[model samples]
Target: MATFQIEGGHQLKGEITPQGAKNEALQILCAVLLTDEEVHISNVPDIRDVNKLIEILGNLGVKIQKLGKGNYSFKSDELNLEYLESQQFKDEGSSLRGSIMIVGPLLGRFGKGYIPRPGGDKIGRRRLDTHFGGFIKLGADFRYNKEERFYGVEAPKGLKGADMLLEEASVTGTANIIMAAVLAKGKTTIYNAACEPYIQQLCKMMVAMGANINGIGSNLLHIEGVDKLSGCDHSVLPDMIEIGSWIGLAAMTKSELTIKNVSWNDLGIIPETFRKLGITVEKRKDDIYIPAHTNGYEVASFIDGSIMNISDAPWPGFTPDLLSIMLVVATQARGSVLIHQKMFESRLFFVDKLIDMGAKIILCDPHRATVIGHDFQSQLKATTMTSPDIRAGISLLIAALSAKGTSTIHNIEQIDRGYENIDTRLRAIGAKITRFD
Candidate 1:
């Protein structure tokens, strides 16, 4: 495996562009399976998970062409349906959670879809029931092959849309059902759907491809089944999670950094959440300029004068993905705050590694933690660590960059799965991180 050796205590300066959204890319890339026409996509992040999904598409006979860096054209004119039944296909599809999305488009166009148990971060129990339940509700037969450990959805008479009240507002599940319903025979209404920017972008892309979708940014979605869909060009929004990470890094290391082309309208409550931690973020057109937090920052209390609590919720609320970064920034702030990671149970386990670096953190339970900041008076001492997941990996990298001395982080493949060329990009802004095999 590869590792990152970072020399901490350096102040980063200059501008950095966020990578294209990884979550959106997963959905958009799989949506290509819904049409046989050519779809040109730009601003694609060259990351491990996305590339793996592209490879799976190629293996399934989708004709792919490289247009340039962060650009590609995909045409699913001919698909190898027989490959879906093979062991090689099962092994490939099982490697990433995004693979589950392929089922919807395949079931929509070809009347059948199959997937192995998808793999992803071991942060919590990510159930596939939300995805399969939607399929079963939409006039499809759902079955799990116990021997092969695979899930399959088949509609021999073709899919017919029906009203569905999602058990949870699961992002991937919402996308999967929408894709399946687009080509279904009747009207489909989805209540309690996930309305995050990722889902919004997917809806826009499908609309561009001629799918009749209403309510792009709300909990209720209505899709009218169409005869077929065409293809269109799309560019993903900047990675909001990466932008949040940069904000945390600048505050923790007291650096001056500008994040470029961040879709401000789509950022939701990310900037305000960071500001609650006392970081100064200036909006320069479409970019965010974070000044050096040298004088130190403090957590802001509520109007009632109660202790501040930063927690994750659905969209328009704090994102669960950024709670890790916020937790790291709180380590160097001037007050205490409680981080409640309600969506995932075990994401807070990485705090143990941060405590080894001299951070004052109390792991109250599996879902919550209380962090007592030292206000830069006590610098974290660098040590060897391992990355837990994509978000936690970047959070630990930010902590390592702000600490004193050198730190080695192993299993950075987790980091590369989301952030594109992270070390090289951070190096351009004056960070001292090197990658080695």
Candidate 2:
């Protein structure tokens, strides 16, 4: 395992480009299994999850070649779909939740899909029953192997579209069923789907590949099942989640940064939410950059001119993934704000570390916390800490980077699951951080 030893209180200054979206890349990579053609993807993030997914795909007989760093060409056009039992599949599949995406594509094209229990952030009980239920609605049968902890679903007649009302608008669940719907027979309507930017990109990509899809931005998706799909080249969108992290990092460290190639359109209310926390965001053409030397941020009032709590909800709302970073950033803001993480129950539990850093936070319950900002600042007091999850791990890095002294973050592999080359990139921006095995 690798740990990050960081010297704090230095500004993370300079201009840097954000990597492609991890969430989007995961889904798009699996879409490769839908067809047997050359599908080139650019701006790929060099991270553990993507590499793991590549290993899984390679095990599935998908040929992948690296043209250069951050660029690759992959072809599953002639994939030996029956060879799904490669050992690499189980090894790599065990470490990433994105591994579950293969189930839909493999089921649609090869008539069967086998996947082991995928791993991700242990923030709480991450359920796959929603995903498997979606698969059942799309005409596939699932049986669990208790010993192996893997699932095998076979769809010999190919998937036939059916009306599905998701139990919850699970983001991964929405992506899984959407992929399966593309090659199914007849029209498929999915209501209460998670229409986050990643899901929209999946639909748009499928549309480009001859899959008929409607309602790109809404929670209700209409996909007309097509017999086949061809390959196309696409550049993954810049990660807005990373953009949020940088925004918080810049504010917390009192630094200036210009994040180039930022997808402003996809940012939605992200910039506004950061602005609410009193961070200054400057937009230039395609880039949404942050200004230098931020003072303490302030709580923004609501539309009815009343104080409002910042919380996560479905799409077109605050993203639950960024809630942890937002809460940490709030500790540096001028006033108090409630970070309501409605999606996951235990995500708010990590705030105790912030309290240890002299942050005033009250964990009301599993889903909510009240944070009073700017009133407390302490010497980050060089401590050895274990990373809990991807979002929280990065947030800890930001906190440590803003502290007065040295901080060593153990198990940086959790951070790597999402952020790409984080230490190197932070160093480029004047942060003193080094990684060691």
Candidate 3:
């Protein structure tokens, strides 16, 4: 396992650019399977989860070539369909949660898709019912092997589109269904779909590839099935989650940092949410300039003097991925705020580590936490900790950077799964972080 040794209380200064969106990369990469022609992709993040999915595609006989840094070309003309049933595939596919997306494109193009139970962060119960349910509604036959924990979907007659009202606006679920519907036989209407930037990017890419799709930035989507799709070049937007993390890091460490080319328009509620916590998020052209919080930040209260409550919802709302970073940043703020993590039940459990670091936090339940800011009056005492998930791992790293002394964090592989070259990036901005394998 890899670990990070961090020396705290250092002010970071410099410009850092956020990598390509990880969530979008996962979905967009899978869409390449829908066409037999070459698709060129730029700004792909070199992270663990994305790399694993790329490797899975290669193992399935997709001709992949590296063009340059953060650029690749994929052609799925002659895929090895038999490889999908091999034991090696089961082992490889089960290691990545994003691998579930490949099933939709495979089932749409090849009429059959099988996947072992996918694995990812142990945050909470991440059900696969939405993905399979959308497939079943589109006329695919679903089968599961309980003993082996495997899932398969097949449509020998090819998929036929149908209207679907999703139980929840699940992002990955919506992406999976959209991929399948692009090649279906009729028009497919999806209501209550996830319209996050990642989903919109996927929709836009599919449209560029000759799939008729409308409603790019709304909860309702309409896709018209086509005979086939042609590949096109696409570029992923900068990761909003990483931008939010950097904003929080700048506030907590009292650092003046400039996050370059952040795709400011795509960041729906992220900047305003941080501003509500009294952190200055200035928009300079396409960049975000976060000045050092020399006097510390203050949590904003409601108009009626009620405590500020921040929660996650569907698109255009606060993202659940950044709630961990928000919670960590609040530890040094001037007032109190309530963080409600509605999507995942167990994500807030990592607050115990912060409590040990001398932060005043109340874990109200599995889904909520109340933080009383220290106002920088008393610095967090450094302590050793273990990363729980990707978000929580980065949250801990931020906390360590703002703490009083040195801190050691184990299980940094969880951190590397999302952020691209995180330690090296931090080092570039004058952070004191060391890696140990």
TM-score of each: 0.99, 0.95, 0.99
lDDT of each: 0.95, 0.85, 0.95
**Candidate 3's error at 15, in angstroms?**
0.4
Give one digit per residue, the lDDT tens place, for model 2 in 345-437: 878888888787777889999998998886325434456687898999999999899887888899999999899989888888899999999
Flag regions of model 3 displaced more than 4 Å: none
Model 3 lDDT per residue over 83-171, tens place:
88899999998999999999989999988899999999988999999999999999999999998889999999999999999999999
Give the TM-score comparing model 3 with the true structure, all chains together: 0.99
Q: How many pairs of residues collide in model 3? A: 0
Q: In candidate 2, which residue ranges exceed 4 Å CA deviation?
A: 86-88, 302-308, 375-381
**Which of candidates 1 and 2 reaches a greater lDDT?**
1
Candidate 2 residue pairs that clash: 36-77, 297-334
- Pairing residues by index, what is the TM-score of model 1? 0.99
Best by lDDT: 3
Q: 52 in model 2: Cα distance from truth in Å?
A: 0.7
Off by over 4 Å in 1: none
* Residue pairs of candidate 1 with colliding backbone atoms: none
lDDT of 1 by residue, 318-405 (tens): 8899999999999999999999999999999999999999999999999999999999999999999999899999999999999999
